[model samples]
Target chain A: MQLTNRSKQVSNKEMTMAEKMYLPSIVQGLAITIKHFFMKKPTIQYPEVKRYLGPVFRGHHVLKRDEQGRERCTACGLCAVACPAEAISMVAAERKKGEENLYREEKYAAVYEINMLRCIFCGLCEEACPKQAVYLRHDRMVPVFLERDDIVYGKDKLVERLDDRYVRMNSEVKATPTEPSLTKAAT
Target chain B: MDLTVLLVKGLIILVIFGITLLIATYSTYAERKVAAFLQDRLGPNRAGPFGLLQPIADAGKMFFKEDFIPAQASKWLFILGPCLAMLTALMSSAVIPFGDSIRLAWDGTNYDIPMQAIEINIGVLYIFGVVSLGVYGIMVGGWASNNKFSLLGAIRAASQNISYEIALGLSLIAILMMTGSLSLRAIVNEQATFFEWNVFTQPLGFIIFLTCAFAECNRTPFDLPECETELVGGYHTEYSSMKLGFYLFAEYINMFVSSAFISSLYFGGYHYPFMNAVHDGLTGSLGEIAGHNIATAIGTVVFFAKIFFFIFFFMWVRWTIPRFRYDQLMNLGWKSLIPLSILNVVVTGAGLLYDIKYTTWLIVVVMVVLALTSNARAPKSQAAPQRA
Candidate 1:
């Protein structure tokens, strides 16, 4: 027969008289508080102030394009397939004649969408992609729009590179990262 | 006919309200700045000239933010909670003598000045009584939130505040014993020299007062009631907008109030070195009043400096210590502080009767003995039996 929740075992009871007194620890605690009262404070100010961000900041998404401006997606559907929440979806379309500069492969994603509502931002899709197309990093704040639809990125909203004033976003400003143990971007 | 006196009283109150509120708000900025500097970083440099305008901006933002009331909350109680908090925070300023009065040379009369917000003879007792009421804000806010965590937080705060109240009152009792007066102005006047300050004479009282201040303000180690880890936002969990702002602002205000009380009681309220020589003693009715007035003004500044020091002290403690366990906190207050405080009173009483000094030594001895004996009387172990 299988057991349910285990019973809580009894603990030994051998309280010392000193422990029972409780004044020493209280004074001890007071001493500690006094020591702290005299010591320096440690708080960081944000915005006008700055601190170093760690190595792995998953800030905003960047869609990598080749030097020739050709999209990097191979239309393998791996990123969509790997998304745990079914947030990503894409439609592949064959490259038109003499339009090879716009397509890195024979087939490319003509219509790609990510349901920001469903997306957990785990960066798993970036890891699962066969082609190094999708990346979530090294950008300023991920702009929050009023509507969820605005956050759900379409092919139109994807940028090949940051606008002129591109600066590397620090890890501190980045979105809260998921597990770093499996930190990778699909290539 | 008596309008002049009433007008002067109102003006003094207005000045105090403005100054204390200004100090408290700026202290918040200072707290942030100090925290930043200690952590080896630059603080707020934006929001108008070295971030002087940050507090104003913060206040504006708080005001404009959508005030959210919880569905389960008692609306009237929730609103009353923060108002009471703000009220208690500001109420303590009534008795503090800011500085010695300076003479006004108008029409060749050169009238004397008065330094206090209002000279209440029973100022110290008033402070004690008013300060205790601060807990109601926490209790009401926490209870009104109607969240289990909030209710638990309220209970913790109620117990913590009540426990610390005893130590606080006992500590003040020792001070009253030394000074033989309860008025804040009289108490400061009594401590003309640095040695005369309760800090030097009744160092035990100073220590106890300092510890109790931390507890009353709900500073670190003793901040189990509003412990953010498990209790989330604690008492103000459901509050949003300006309601939340009031709670946070009230905290800083309380810090200011505690600073004032501590300065008056222990550090000598606004009494500086060689202050009397700086302002020659008044001879005639006008002169005597003038001399005390100058002393009061100087005393006020001194008081402020001490209060700011403690405010900075509060910030320092917040960064230094993590919180205590629930049972551990209770034990510290009830079991340790109360008994030792009682003993301190007893010995202090005896010392008073015998005319014996070196209270510093006596306090140290008692502390040492308390430390040694407490270990021998340790509470029963709760270690779980080893599983096979």
Candidate 2:
């Protein structure tokens, strides 16, 4: 085990009478403050301005649909398995012969829920999804909630529209690039 | 005619008051900016012109802030603290000599006016009295908060003030020895030549006075009350929004007042080089000229310039140094500085007896030595540094 002696130990110690008065030390501190008076300020003016973001920035979540305007999730339980917070839940339904257009495949989610309260929004579920269905977008999706319950977003909230016009507008990730599939899915 | 003069004087006072309030506001901005720079970080640059408009923005923020009053706090005392702090901060500026006097011309006649709002003969005493009273602001605020930390902070502030007040008064007694006048204006006039500033005559006294002033103001290196680490916002912990803002504002104002006092006392308040000559020159040129009023006005400007420079210096010192421990702070004030100041007086008295010139440098050197010697700290048994 590491020793607590390191915590108590003061390295590089030798102080003069002048250092003890603390005047010169204080002066050194002042020099730094004085130096900052002329330094460049980093402030992004809000509303009228926005800072640029990198690729794969997961800001806000949106649902994605296929070219035929079908929901992308296969309801194979991939996203729910990946979610660390246990935020994603779904009731899978077996597609009948006449229900081919309702889902991308034979399985469809009869009920889907994402507990926004439990979700830390780390986007692990988005990474875990084998079907490239879930995505966490950049920017503060919304301001931190006024009510505790307001944070828990559900089925109507989580899905993204995978349409050509919608994908064109949100192609570039503003904060962090999550994965290569996000770009392909957008395309 | 007197009524007209009164009206004019009132206008000038109003203008000066406005300007001082404005300065106080901006000084807060400067304090933050300085702190930011010292820490190698950017501070408040959002409002306008590299945060030039920050004071106004801050004022807006304060006005709109949640004025929190703790349920446990004494309601009357809670309100009383910031009120006293703000009032006392503004009151001292009234006696401040802003610039040289200006002539108020009506038709063919011009009347000479004192640049200051009031020119009391006992200006120095009045200032000392007022500043000493400034302690009540912190004391009342801290006590009313009803928290143990707040009460502890108040106690610290009260004791600190009590200690430094003595040193401040004693240091000035030495300067009073040389100037022989309590009138601030007179003191400045006596040091009209740039070379004859009191800092040269009584450098030891000046250092002592300055050190004591910093202590009195509870500035860093002596700031025991709001020692953020241990106290957790100290006396003003419960104060939210504008109330806390006022307490913070008072600190800057205290710095400003100390700067003014220092400039007036030692650096020659409002007195400029060749001021007497300039007065004579102008009078000769104008045939009775605009006269002494103009000279006084010039002196006033010079005085304020010096004060602001010191204010800037105060901010500089604040950003530079960490605070002293309570024990160390008390020890320095009572033990080292007090004895050194007494020694300074004794030395100054002898030098005066001998009628020596340039002995001020000797005082400065001695003070430097004494300060250095006292700072000869003992070896620490506990290698860990505790929060001051």
Candidate 3:
């Protein structure tokens, strides 16, 4: 990179009679200020008037679910691996005989946690999730907490309720080829 | 004084005092609002709708604050400082006439009540004395604080007032020459018509007087005494709580009274164009007594409107100009204003002696020449630099 000289010489000439009087310039300055006085004040009164966030806004994380009210995460650990801050952690578990309705496939995440303090909202986990089990919510925000442990979100907080709007939107994930063939898996 | 007259006078004084206090309170709110508006923002809207009750809230806060004095401070003088400031500030308003006489029909006996609190013969002189006494408030407070910055601020204020007071007096001399009386009432009567305002006759003097008034009030660009950048809080650096509030509050009161003085002295007081016509018309339609009251009411409103304009002008100028450098302030006051004022007096005196109408024309001619010559001499090559 090339650096360029940015400084310029300042003139030190004495003020003329007009400049000395100062009334004319003062009058002009006043006129400008009065013009601004009538201009629209660009203030957003917070809380009552929430500003629009763009569609691509990355906020809090949400664990997705399939149409059958089953967890979509196969515990492949790709999202955990992709998280730059090492914020994501989860334990894998094999689905038992009676848990067929709960688990979409043989493998499911038993305990998923994300430390919100460590998370930078970079959406890398969402990008890395091949099965599309986790995505950053556009509308929701990570609430501040006083205690460090409180900020580390567990599966109870991370997992979206089946009735949530995002979960209904994610119900389409059942059609994806990544989901196991249901009849074969059931048998 | 007769018992009834004394009672009436006392009541009028009370009413005027209340009005002055109320106006001074609201002036603080107005100053903030105006400053905010100039910067394209809303100011203090949480206290009440449009922040109408802001002064009341501010006073409450001041009252509730813990009044503290510095460990090594002169407690008595420190306490006395702001009291003197406020007392002197309120005192000057007594001589200013808010309106013409109003006839009151009390128990079938009509008595004419004048709007001024005290109709002293030397009204202008009394005001000047009271205003000069304002410096004591600053000096005492700053001296009592035992702080170097406070001392510096006190000194700046003292010198600034002394310098500007000369120019102030000189400029008023020109007005006094024309009015031929020191009584504020007589001065107002002289300018009984709109165009006959001393501003038209003594434009140069008016400019000088206005400039001096800014210095006297310690407002920017003459506010070197309290320029926060240089002297912390200036004279009030050691002051806290309601003691500090008094110094700050007195400033707005001073602004109010000076605005009143400016309106009364130069801007035709309560005189409006076609006032006599309106009064006559009302008198013809209504009875003489009712018409006179209405006319006086209109005059009072007009007078207040003038005062408000000047107050707004003060705020406007504040938001526009930067504070003067100490040297520049001294130069402006002593070198420029004083000389110009002296010249104004000489010219006005000569013009008055020759003919009354000649004085006005001469002033106009002089103003035009000065403006044109100054404009012609401005450097041709200096273009305003473009922003990066």
Candidate 4:
């Protein structure tokens, strides 16, 4: 029934006068702290310097667009359904004939919102999307919200702009004009 | 005293006052910085460059905080507490000789101005009296609060100070025996050379004094009175705003005065190695007046440097050692330090009769032999308990 070798038997024996003095131990402790005083500090000054989060890091959410820069989402409720935190919500609207350039499909999301406070950043919504519409960006994190109202992100904040698009570093997906996906979808 | 002397004395007092406050203020910042460095972290760099303005920021915060007092607290004594603490802390620096005298010629008459606020024959006694009075501040504040915890803390502080003061005084007696004077300036002048420092002659006494100083200042390892873990802010629990600031500031001031006293008493004060050579060279090159003044200036700077080192040492020990238990603290002060200091005094007395150098060597030899014998007698390793 012997335990691990690491267990130390507590000594109840009388301490030597030297041990009782505590000066030697105090000197040893001071030496340790003085050594640490000169050692390199591992603190990273935040705001000025940031540690690199890996490519798979789930961060801020983004609503992507098609090759032609049209909204990729077809107002599908799958993401909202798949969200464990139930953070995502949207309103579907049928696309008008004149707005074909704006919507990639016959149906589009008119209003999309995600409560950042509730969203667990589990990437479940990203996995549930039929089209590659929603993704948690690896590069940027959601800025800290100051107001309660600011915690709920709307389409205006999430939608990807054509000029400055969100690109996944590890993915082969691109928005080149030579791509035939838009024509295939139209046909 | 004439008008010029009065003016000079006034100027010196003002300078000393400014310096004490300045050092106390920066000691807070330094304490934080040192604590951080020891713990391998960068502390307080945002307020200003290297957080140099952190003390100012802290003072501003203290001033703006709402002044508070417990309803059950005695209002008058509560107000008097921090004032007394601060007053006593400031008063102790008056007799410390910062440097050699500055000679001035006015109205065809020569006058010499000592770089001290006031010269008193009983400087050491004055310092001890002021330091002892410092405890009254804590006691009054704690008692006035009418809180059980505060009262306990105050009691602890009072008892701790009283206990350690004996050892501290006994340790000083060894030095006094050597120098034959209680005046701090005389003590410094006695140790005019590097090797002649009291630390060399009375190493045992220096150790005891240092330990007692740490306890008397209510620093870590002897800081049971204000220990947050047990006493919940301790003696100043009921104080708020600038009153709390005053209590905290008074501690730093006490630390400053203690460092200065330690420097002046034990470490050769303004005297440095090869000071004679430096003085001679300066005087030989420049005229006597200019050279003497410059030398004095250097000595003052050196004195300040020693004080700073001791201050840093105080913080160093704080960060290094954990606080002592109440019983352990008492045992060390009453049992260990007191007896050791008494021994130190006897040894110093004996040394004065014989050769001091021989006596010091003998003590060292005895201590080494005792340590070796103790190590040899210790059981090598107790066999591990047999498993059930």
Candidate 5:
């Protein structure tokens, strides 16, 4: 009839003379506290200092730019489909004539948004993006925002502001690691 | 007293009062810092660099806070309580000698300015009387609150202070028996060196006095009245704003005064090891005027160092030990500490009469054995709780 056999019997054991005196135990406790008093305090100043996040840390999403200074997203809608929280949404637009400098492809997202409140930062969107446009950047993370609307990150907040040459150099190095001469020539 | 003496005395009184107040204010900061350190965390560092201006910020906050009074509370008595607490706390410092007489040159002649506010004859008795009166503040504040918790806390505080006072007086009697004087100055003079300190002679008595002191101060381990778990802020539950600040300030002031008292009574006051030799050596090298002043300064520094150490120890114990249950506290006060202190008085008397140096050791040994055996033979109700 017993629900569980986990309960142990409580012992009403008698205390020894030393234990009864209470002085020894108090002294022992005092010694321990003093030891801690001299021990190195492990306090992080926080804002001025930060703990090193691991390499695999998944942070806020970044809508990346290609080496040619054009947006990488082709409005494939894969990232939105992969977003488990349904946080990502976008309005696909057709590229107008002479808009080749702005859009990398004929199809581009005119209005893209991610509701940060709903995002779990699981990096699934990054993995689902075929164009390598959406990435969880290691350098930047979600900032604390007061309003719910403020946390909804737009392309203006998410896009990288690196120079075109730096982007070209970085992409050349990452893409053609086997061809050192090509990367050097690209840089 | 002449005008010069009166002015000097006035100056000393003002300086001591300011220092006591400053120390009490900063002790709140120190308490948090120490507590934080013990728990491996950083305490308030935002007010100013290292939180140095925390007390000033706190004072400002308290001043601006809305002063609340319960509708059912007795307003006048509630106000009187903290004032009485603070007054009694500061009054004890009047009898405590801060340092030996400082040689001052004025009007083409030198004068010796004793570092006490008032050199009262009955220093010990004055301290006892003031301490006993302190309970009235807590009781009045609690009763005036018109709250059940406050009333309960006040009753607990009243009973605790009264019970501990007996043990406290008895323990002091042991020291008085040895010193043969009621004056704190006399007690200090008796123990003019480290070895002569009453702490060595009356270890058991010191232990008893210290335990009772914790109770008297309403510090942790004996802070049953204000214990958060049971009483919910205790006597000061209904208090708010500057009134609450006053109660807290009074507690720290009491702690500061008690530290000085303990140091004066048992730790040889301003006396250090080889103090006389150092003074004589200084005088032998430097001229008497400068040498004497320097020695006094050193002694003053040493006295303050001892007081700070005791204050730190008080905080250390507070963080280390948990509060005692009400009944256990009562039992320890009435049954154990009182009887032990009584025995301590008798033994100290007998030892002093015999003029035996080893008698203290004998008494200490006896005390240890008696305590252990007594606890072993104690009833089940009084059996020691298992330590965590």
Candidate 6:
């Protein structure tokens, strides 16, 4: 039974003296390697030149902020429940009387941590978020962690900075078209 | 010997030593670069521009590495092994004629100093002896390690070197018979013209010597002694730190020396095509002394160029050919190369008796006819029997 036409029959014939000499074959091999010696090398100088990951690629996690720079997460535990790796944890706290500018909702996350070592970067937390707060940034990747303490990222690392906003590529095309209200709320 | 001559010779020796070491050091880098290039990848370019400082970095690393000697190992012999290897490797270069004499005027006396460390009458024999002794380094190192693999490796090395050295010496004898001299400088002097190069006369001998040299140096395709897959770093398995570095450095030095030897012996060392014409022309234009010195300088450069090409060829072959199975290597060395070299010697002797030009042409014709006839007669593989 032939699997493909590329398969060749194994020959057990005695080698000719010419073949046994190995000089001709060695010259042929040398010719081949010399050709490759001048050929263009395909090595990418990695640290200096990073390859562009596609737009939909899930990478480092980011907690969103509102237009007014208020925290968008409402201390909701839906993202934690949705995470397949169970990598997310949070502490909820009530919004203070004069903290409306700081908190977008009555309740706020006092502490939010994501174990990057455990998280699979599946973007499920982004999907399960009701407040449009959790997102996996397409442009940035989670840097390699050196210590045990560095792997579990808290609000300091995860929260979106006011000056540096996380923007999605073609949000209208990627997001569900049926959910107009969610899109409007996100904008 | 005058004190000034001694001083000059000492300086020349120092220069040769420095060059040998420098070439050996950079060979490691060149080996990596060539390997990477052959595989279509960039080699080391991190340390400095094109990783020029890589060998220096490697030396530093070797120096910093822990000097380890196993409790069960023979300590003194283990230490002596690398030193012996390096010593023999360095010693072989002393007899190689780098170029013709350079005229140096010193203390109101003109001295024509030959560009060789020691112009001994028995340069070829000395080289052969040193090369043979090189295997002892591997053997001692492997044996002293007290490991089964190292012992096997050492045994392989000893047997391999002994077997190949016969063919190596025999192949050389064809050229020695033609030149009728054992001195390397004499052999080089005989092949002053391009066509007169020993390679043209003794092509078979050159091929055999090259194969033997590969086997002698333990380069890939003939590196059975240090078959890393089987021997786990071979003779240097139990070695660490600068000791292991010494073993590796010695191999490179051996490679460099063999390249130089090949250049001097077969390719006509310090001799280029129309060299006499060039020397005469230069002599007519410039003064005699200046022309002669410039010509000698050019010849030296040409000799070095030949050595460099051969070194590259060595690396090229290393990357191209796969390691030979032990039996195959033995078969080639003993059955094929040895017999071929013996035939080459007989042919050379016959050529000398008759017209060498006619004899060489006759041999070429015979080889071509034999190849054609063999190819025509070679049986094709029979088709597999069809199932009933």
TM-score of the candidate numbered 3? 0.85
Better of 1 and 2 by DockQ: 2
Give one digit per residue, the lDDT tens place, for model 3 in B285-345.
8877898889989999999999999999999999999988999999888899999889888
RMSD per candidate (Å) reads 8.8, 6.2, 5.5, 4.2, 5.7, 3.1
Clashing pairs in 6: none
Worst 10 residues of 4 chain A by lDDT: A175-184
User: Which regions of candidate 2 are displaced past 4 Å?
Assistant: A1-21, A36-58, A62-77, A89-118, A137-186, B46-87, B137-151, B228-249, B271-302, B353-357, B366-388
Clashing pairs in 4: none
* Chain B of candidate 6 vs. true chain B, TM: 0.95
Q: What is each predicted model's overall lDDT from 0 to 1?
A: 0.74, 0.76, 0.86, 0.88, 0.84, 0.89
**Candidate 3 segments whose C-alpha is farther than 4 A from its true place:** A1-10, A67-134, A140-164, A167-187, B1-4, B106-109, B357-364, B374-379, B382-388
- Give residue B337's error in model 5 in angstroms: 0.6
DockQ, computed on Cα atoms, for candidate 2: 0.28
Candidate 5 residue lDDT tens string, B268-293: 99999999999999878986767888
For B101-152, candidate 1 gives per-residue lDDT tens digits of: 6455555656544566778889988887888898899899988888988888
Which one wins by TM-score: 4 or 5? 4
TM-score, candidate 6, is 0.92
* Tens digits of per-residue lDDT for model 6, B89-147: 99889999999877766666667888899999899999999999999999999999999
- Candidate achieving the largest lDDT: 6
TM-scores, one per candidate: 0.66, 0.75, 0.85, 0.93, 0.88, 0.92
Q: How far in Å is the alpha carbon of B297 misplaced in model 5?
A: 1.4
Q: A1-187 in candidate 6: lDDT tens per residue?
A: 6555565567877877667768878999999999999999899998888888766778889998988889999978999999999999999999999999998999999999999989999888888888888888777899988898898999999999988887774544463322223342453
Which lDDT tens digits does candidate 2 get at residues B1-388?
7898788689888987787777788888887876776566667887897799999987889889988898989999999998898888878877776666677677788776777778888888888888878889889999999999988888999999999888888888777777778888788777878878988887777878998998888888788888889999777877888888888888877788788889988898887778779889877876564666666667767777887889878877876667788898888889978887887777777777787745657766765787667565545546456444
Task: Give the true-contact fraction for every prediction, in order.
Answer: 0.15, 0.54, 0.61, 0.76, 0.41, 0.69
TM-score of 2: 0.75
Candidate 4 DockQ category? medium
